[model samples]
Structures are given as C-alpha cells and as structure tokens.
Target: MSDRHIQFQTLSDLYDDVLPADEREAVRRHLQSCEACALEYRRLGDTLKLCREYAGLSLPLDGLNDRTMSKIRSARTRRLVLRSLPAMAASVLVIVGVGLFSTGTVFVRDRATVAGSRLSYSDSERVIDIIRKHNATISQVTGEYVEGTVPVSSFNDLKKSMGFRRVAYMMVDESMPDENVHWGDAIEEVGHDTGQPVRDWAPLTGTGASRQYVRFRVFR
Candidate 1:
C-alpha cells in the first residue's frame, strides 16, 4: 500500500462539504484506489453519522422547533409586560390620586400628603410676599395667583418662600366658575412640560379675571 495517496486535510475538506465538485470527485477516486485511506474515510463517515444519531436521541425532536419558539416568544412577552408594569401602576396611581384629591384642597408646603398639614394661616402673608416680590401678579380676590412665563428667579423665590421642595404650574380655566375645567388635561400638560407632579391647587375666584391663571392656596 502506498504511504501517501490523499492527505487527511483534503479528506476533511471533502467530508465537510467545503471541496468543489471536481476536487471532491478527485478525492473520491483516490479513496477508491487506496485501501488505507478508504478505510479511514469510512470510519470518519460512520463516526459522524453515529454522532448525529446520538444527538437526535438526546434531544426531543417532537415539535421541538415549535415548542422552543413558543417558549422564547412567551419569555419576551413576559419581559415586555414586566418592563411596562411600573409606568402602568404609576399612571393608575395618578388617576386614582387625582380623583381622590380633585374635590379637596392641596397644600403648597414642602411635604405633600393626602391629609395636608404644615400649611396654615401664619405662612399666608409670607407666601403672598414671595409671590409679589417675584413680580408674579396676584388676584385682588384674597387668594394666591401667578401667571406663567415669569422669570426663573421669581419661580425659585416662590418655591423657597412657600417651603416647598418642588413646585408645579397648574393651568386654570377662568370660564369654569363653579368647577375646575380640564384639570386632568392641565396636569398632564404641565407635568409633560416641567417633568414635575402637580401638587398644588388654588381656588378659581370670581374677580372678573378673563384669562386663565396659576393659583396658590394653603390647604388647612
């Protein structure tokens, strides 16, 4: 038997289906002529076939692709819902919180709670001064009021003066005399613009005010 006929490298390429058809035919001819190479090639082919058979036995082949794909899709759906849960809960909370407090008054103080406290008559005069010095126009109706587009300095002063850690701009419709109009819509608009929660409320008084205004009031 000849010590060399075809190299194992060529045989490997042929087995892997990487060899061109002509080269593959050439290797096949060499394998047919050489007994040693032919035996080795047959052994390699048998080993690969056995490995494939073993793999088929080890893995579940009944609806395997469908089941695996279904599991993957389910996992992705679960992850998507989990990601959206907080935003959903927060939206629900905002709706519920607004409904609960919409009819009642809210404090402009630093700490905002359902049962409002820390807002009293003693801070009313100081709060008004803070609003006035900031060049924020107030209603002559004895309630707190300010207009939008004021200077940032005045806004900060009002917040500090009111002892509130945060402040929100609420849009009021003067046309709605008895009740707040577009309150939720206003809250959404202001929240989107300022990225802050609307935590303050003031009465819309009948002072012959023709335009919408931002009002401030201390909740008792």
Candidate 2:
C-alpha cells in the first residue's frame, strides 16, 4: 500500500485486544510487511507494558469488570445513537490527520480524516455545531470540508459525541506546515487510508501539544 492504512490508536486497540477478530487479523497482516508499522507496534507494546508497571507501583485502579462494562455501555450507546440518527445525520465520517507540530502554524499533535460521500448542507451545519461546541478554531470551510484546531482535552468527547471512524495517520512534507494542508489536498497526493472505520483517536497530550487539527471533508 502506498499509504499506511494502520492508525496509531488502531494499533493500540489491537494491543489491547479491543478489535474484532477479522479486523485484528487484517492489522496483523499489514504489520508483517510494513516495517514502520511493525516497529511502532513493538514500541507501543513496550510503552503499555511500562505504563502498566508504573500504574501498579503507584496508581489505584478500577476493577476489570467495571472497565469492561463501561466499554460495553459506551459501545451500546454509540450504536443506539447511530441507529436513531436520521438520514440527515452523517452516515460516515473518515478522519485522517498529519504530523505533530509544536510551534508555528497550529500547535497540533493529533489529526482526523473523514472519507465518504459529501455531506448534505444540513448535516454540514450539525458537524460545524459540534466543532464549535468543542471550541475548535475554524480556519477554513469549503463545501463539506472544515479545517481547524480542536482542543486535546475535548477531542474524545467531540469524536464520541458525534460517533466516528478513523483512518491512518499521515505526515505532510517538511516544507509544509501540517495545519495548512486540507484533507482533500493531501489525500490526492498520499492516497486515502484503506483500513475499515473503527474507534477513537490516538491519545494526544504533551507539552506544546495543546490542540489538534480536526480538519475534515464530510460537511458543507
């Protein structure tokens, strides 16, 4: 594949055993050939191992049952919301984000890409409302495409509240600031992610990593 179809969060889910059997197998096959993804998969495992060890040393934790049930409830809620949504609701959203930047342009550490049919005008308004509700900065709006920065703290709520499917991670050329490129411009060049839609974004937090570009092309 010209563009990597694996997402950071998707790999994390695989490591955590959260993906369905077929999906998990697909990622495994991809990892076998993609050296970078394979390396990342290993590193992610190491990091999670360390985190688990660290938490065991210091942090209190909820029981496994509580955690498991919480995920079950959350998944059920998303399913219910999606089923109840009208035709006017966004049927599919594909989020693809680029590299993490620290200073110039926008200080973004996360990216979201949506690839599907163009959104209807009414649906576009609702998408914009969610972006605004999360206090994301809107820099560009062209047809169904919206480009801007979303806060790290609120990204999950925004993603979950709306329901979503994520694509692979992408990094733009060094000459271009990630915040400046729209998904449309980039997708044509690097190609779109092939991975099936799945869950949440990669965890985003760090010094100078305050907001992520929630640039999308699914709304007006």
Candidate 3:
C-alpha cells in the first residue's frame, strides 16, 4: 500500500482501536518501519497527554459570577419598582385631578342661581331675545341667513345702555342649502373684519330650525 494509505489506516486504528488484531499488528509493523508514521504517533500522544494534564487542573475564579448575578437581580428589582412608581403616581394624579374637576363642577351647579341673580333682567334673557330686542336686523343672502351689522353695534350699546356687566354676541347661520359654512367660519370672518382676533371673541353654538348658529359671550 502507499505511504498515505498506510498513514490513514494507522491513525484510524490508533484513535478507535477498532481494527482486528491481524490488521493492528500489520499497522504496528508498518509504523516501526516508517519514520513519518512514528513521528505522527509521538506527536498525537504528546498532544493527548498535555490535554489530560490541563483538564485535571482547577480553573481560577474572578469572584465576578456571584457579584454579577446579585447586581442583575438588584437592577431588575429597581427597574420594576421604577417602572411601577410612574404608573402609581399617574393613577394618583388622575384620581386627584378628576376629583378636583368634579368638585368644581358641583360647586358651579349649586351656585348657578346665585350667580344668575347678580345679573340684570335684560342680561339674563336668552341671547336670541336680546338680539331681537336690540333691533338687530337679519338678512338672507346666498341661501344663508346673515345677521345685520346691528348685532355688533347693539351689543356695544347694550353694554353701555343697560350697564350690562358683560355683553355677549349670538350669531345663527341658518343656511338652508348648505351646512358646510359653519358659525366658526363666520365668527372668524367677522373677527377679521372687526380687526379683532377670533379667539378674543368666544364663539359658542346656538340652536336653529335648519342651520347652525354661533353664540358669543359677554361675561362680567
């Protein structure tokens, strides 16, 4: 057989010890005659002996494993508590805020009559009645019912005339053919024309037969 074939069979038998006695004897005979096979056998034996020696030695400890595990557990607990604190605080804040808001609403509802008593007779009238009494003219244009400029002027007059502590404006846009043109848009347009900011004129909703209306508040 070739030297390569002999080396392969010899290494296989040396590692497994599975070759028959006759074959083992033949490989041993060939190893004794072949210097290359003897050198390989010696090198494999030395490597295995070194591995066994290293395996028998005890590995050194750095004390990091136990400390790291303890730190991890501590950090996990801290993270869990930190995460829970915000939710707990948020729940408390929400509960307190809701309680305060509810209390304020109840207080307002209880004192509504007392608050209304402070206002004058004309001031207490519904905005639509106030608008009509002030001789505020109304016109229908482009299928939209537009209140005349009198509402704005009368509102000023009512504030001065009745000593109306707070005068508010009520506008109804009863556009039968179109609902898209909202009161807010009208208020904004009016505000722009009046050289006042839209937000400065507090615009609220009013009921209409077929369209929407905006109500402006005059508060003392």
Candidate 4:
C-alpha cells in the first residue's frame, strides 16, 4: 500500500506512538504528501500536547471521594432497613397474636356470652313496659313545655300549676334560650313573642328521674 493509505489506516494506532520504527517512518512519509493524513497527524499532535499540559496540573480534592463513599454506605444502610421493616413488623404482629391468644379469655368469653344470650321472656316483657312508660312520660313533658300556640287562658293556668313566679311571652331569639335551634330558624322567628322553649326542661324518666333539676328547676 502507498505511504498515504498506510498512514491513514494506522493513524489511530500510531497516535499513541507505540508503532514499530518502520511503521512510524512510513506514517511520517505519508503525512508529507497526503493532506488529509497530514491534517489527522497535526490534530493528534495537538491533542497530545494539550493532554501533556493538563497532566502536570493537579486536580482539586474537596473531600468528595469520602463524602461519596459515606453517601453510598448510607444508601446501603437505608436499603437494608427498608428491606427488614416488613419482617420486623411481621414479628411484632406475631408476638401480639401470641399474647392475645394467651390472655384474651375474659374478653372472648364476654363477647361470646353477649352474642349468645337472650333476655328471659318475662324480663323482655318488663323491659318493654318500662320503655313504653318512659317514652310516654317524655312525650307528655315535651308536649306540655315546648313553646307555641297555647290559649292565653291556658297559659295562665299552666303558669299557676307549674308555680312559676312570673310568666310572660317575650320576643327572644330561639337560640338565646336553646342553642339546639338552627340559626336560620331563630332568625326567621325573630319578632314573634313566645315563652322560652322549655323553661323547665327535665328528663321525665330513667335514672335521671331523681335528677336535681327535676326538683329545683322544674317542679319547684
């Protein structure tokens, strides 16, 4: 092959200057005639010269190698913790399950008995009667005391029977006497004079029957 062809073909290999002496001489001869090969040789020479200049200059160290190694270790530890978390949680669940199985007798027994037992037939009847009486009392008390649309004469009789010191209808916001009234309803009924919604509000039955409010606030 011609010197030009040989040099072009082998320029990459010869760039390292590792070629045999004969091959290097051939490449030099080729570069003298071949413009393209000559240009390649000059470019390689420039790159080598630049590399040599930079080689003498020290690369800066900002402790990056140690920091990078620390980050890698941290990442590895995190991965290990993440991988083990499910197993740790599962072990805790198993321990809890064993404890529950050992100590849960009373809880399980109460649950089972409550689920299985029915009240005796006579007890059921007594319960029904008590509930009915309680409901009736509640209805009567709520009906008698809830404010609105009573005859004036009846109102006076009611006030006397209930032993109120004074009784008078007054325009008051429904929410003033009872916060349970919706704001919209209270605003709508703003101007109407009515008795306080339940001045003597009291539970009429249940364990609450002996409640102090019944004696002091209501009956008295």
Candidate 5:
C-alpha cells in the first residue's frame, strides 16, 4: 500500500537472475501487493522471451549485442539511404532494396539463409559450440535442422568454421516487419531455389550485417 515503487535497476537485476537472493525475495513480496510493478515486470519478461524466440526462425514470416558489437558490424555494410532514384518506391522506408543484381542475388530484407545436406549429423556439438562462441542464440533444433541467430559481423566466421553452406543472404534492418519464419523451412527452400552446393557457396557477412542476428539455418 506504500505508494513507493521499486527502481528499474532492481527489476532488471531480478530479471537477469543477478540480484542477491534476499533482494529478489523482497522484490517478489512487493509484487504480491503491488499491481503496477508486477505488470511492468511481466511485460519486460515477455518482451525478452519473444526476442529469444526470434532465433528459431523460418521464411518471410521473418523477421545483440554484445550489443555494441552489433552496432559496429551492422554499420559496416548496411547503409540507410533515402534518395530519389529512378522509379524508386514513393514509400521508400527501405534500406536494403537494391542488391548485387549482376550476381542475380534475390533480395529479401533482414534475412540470411544457409543450407547444406553436407552438414554432418556428427558435427552437432561442433556446430553448437561455434554458435555459442559467437554469442548467438539457438532457439530450436530438430533432427532435420538447427536454427538460431548470430552476429552478422561474425557470420562469416561461423560459415567457414562449419561446413554448413552459406548459400544466400539479405540485409537485416530494424524497419522490417515481424513474420513467423523458421530455419528448417528456409534451408529446404533456398537449397531448391539456388541449386548451389555447400562448397560452391560464398560466406555471409550479413555484410549489411546486423549483430544480434545474422540468423542461420543449417540442414542437419
């Protein structure tokens, strides 16, 4: 009933599981009597949970950081240009619209798809380890596919280390819409579409490389 509320740092610490046990318990007890703080706490948890779920992704239903790293890498290739080019869309809030047309690279904003039947089932642990080293999150893994997001800057490293092919990629931008995409589905589709084997493919830079996710899907 005290109009006093807990501070933001306390709530953040609690969410991160970093607060001392006594402070955590005190916060919980306060939540029992306080509606507003509890609601805020729930919302924070929900948002982070949804973000984590963003990694186990699939197609156009698409959609860091060691976050400072993300900004640095994302800035490397991703340029946000608002210009009046010939026949440009009137509503060009677009950042990654034009791609290397000479290579016939089809552009889908904010996604990078990788695939390989060559991805050995035996390297499951190695794959996980590499992803882990990159500070990426693995959202889901079934026998057919391993799905997750990695730092775009480091994506090339991941591609080379693992034999998993870096078949195709597009820029990741904040302005993109959220869709319900998944890794398993993307690999199957891209492989069929591009017809490139694992060895023949080039590495992904996410060159428009966003950090928190240069999402990857590899066939297991």
Candidate 6:
C-alpha cells in the first residue's frame, strides 16, 4: 500500500469514530506506518486522558457549577457582542447617512466640533449629549459604563487601574489636540498614547473637560 499523509481532520474524525469502515481501516493502516501521525495521535490521546482526569477531579469550592455557568454565559455574551459590532457600526452609518440626506441637517452636531477652538465648550456639551444618547443603545449589549477617573500614564496602567480587559477611553480635548477632533479620533489618540487598543468611546465629563486626567469605562 502507498503511504500518504493523513490529514488532521481525518485523524480527528477517526478519533471521534465517525469514519466509514473502509476509510477507518485505511487510516488505521496509514497510522501504523506513519511515525509522525502516530506521535500526533498519542498526543491527542494524552490530552483526552488529561481532560478525563480534570473532569473526574473533586475540588472544594462553593457554587462551582454556578460560577462556571456564569463565566460561560459571560463569555458567550462577549462573543455575541463582538460578532455584532460590524453590523452595528454599519447600521449607525446608514442611519446617519439617511438622517443627513432627509433632514438637511448633520446627524451628529458634534461631528465638526474641533479641539482648542472657542466653540469647543458649548459644542462639546451638545456633542456629549449626543454621545450619551448613542451610549444608551450601546449599553444594551456592552452593559453600563463603569465611570471613573484615572491618572494619565500608559494604556496598560489605565486598564490595570480600571480592572477591565477591553475598554475605550474618552476625555474632552483641552489643548494640544491632534488633527483628530472627532470623538472616535480623540479616543484613538488615547489608545495610541496609552499603548492599548479600544473599541468604543463616549464622553465622560462635559464642558469642563480635563486634559491631564481622563474618565473611561469597560463596557463590552
């Protein structure tokens, strides 16, 4: 019989015992000659043995099932939110485009609000109102923002201080503002400055926005 490399998927199916009899026999014969496939099969066997050991372990912990289920639910929810993000952004863009085309008015008034300009104060206040309004929809999936202040340093420090895995930070651009005046741009700057990645952003404080300090949250 000619020797051929058995595919990982074929091996997986063989382990799961879902292969037809002829294919199973063929794979069995291949495994007998292929030292590399034999080693991989042994590794899979060891992993299964470990899983069995883990399943049979009795740990002293209260509410273990509840905690495990809770984590599972949280993980599933996060996955759902992550999966939905692109659609949500597209929907928002479509809504804004329609509003702009129909009403002859900008959907987000703060879209043009620039940093360090005289109009920033009142304009940002209005913009923040718009942000809060949009935040209502975002909170449906990400949960409410845990509002708090953190000292400006690095992105890792900010995340560590807030106790969040994924987050987006926002603050009013007081001065020394980069060309990005929009909320998304400003938040991106924060991400760059702090060396952390962000997904969503919203206003933390209105009018009297600070430059040194920032308020942020972990929502999704």
On a 0 to 100 scale, what is the lDDT of residue 207 in model 3? 49
Ranking by TM-score: 3, 4, 1, 5, 2, 6
Model 6 Cα displacement at 57 (Å)?
Answer: 1.1
Report the lDDT tens digits of candidate 6 across residue range 66-164: 999999999988875774475457445644544443454645544434122222333323322333333321211111232233334343444533322
Per residue, candidate 2 scores C-alpha lDDT tens digits across 54-129 of 8778555669789899999999888645533531132222221111111123342342232234353454556667
Considering every candidate listed, which one attains the maximal lDDT?
A: 5
lDDT of 4 at 55: 93
- What TM-score against the true fold does each predicted structure earn? 0.33, 0.30, 0.34, 0.34, 0.32, 0.28
TM-score of 3: 0.34
The residue-by-residue lDDT of candidate 4 on 131-167, one tens digit each, is: 2232111111110122221222233333334332222
Residue 216 of model 4: what lDDT? 11
Q: Please give me the total number of clashing residue pairs in predicted model 5.
A: 13
What does candidate 5's lDDT look like per residue over 58-158, in tens digits? 54531133667778777754542221121133112111212221123644343333223323334555666676676555644543455565556676666
Q: Return the clash pairs for model 4, or none.
A: none
> Which wins on TM-score, candidate 4 or candidate 5?
4
Model 1, position 61, has a per-residue lDDT of: 71
Please list the residue runs of candidate 1 whose C-alpha ends up more than 4 Å from where it truly belongs after superposition. 1-3, 58-104, 107-220
Give the Å error, residue 124, model 5: 1.8
Error of 1 at 105 (Å): 1.9
Q: Any residue pairs clashing in model 6, and if so which?
A: 155-194
Candidate 4 C-alpha error for residue 101, in Å: 2.6
In candidate 5 the C-alpha lDDT for residue 67 amounts to 67
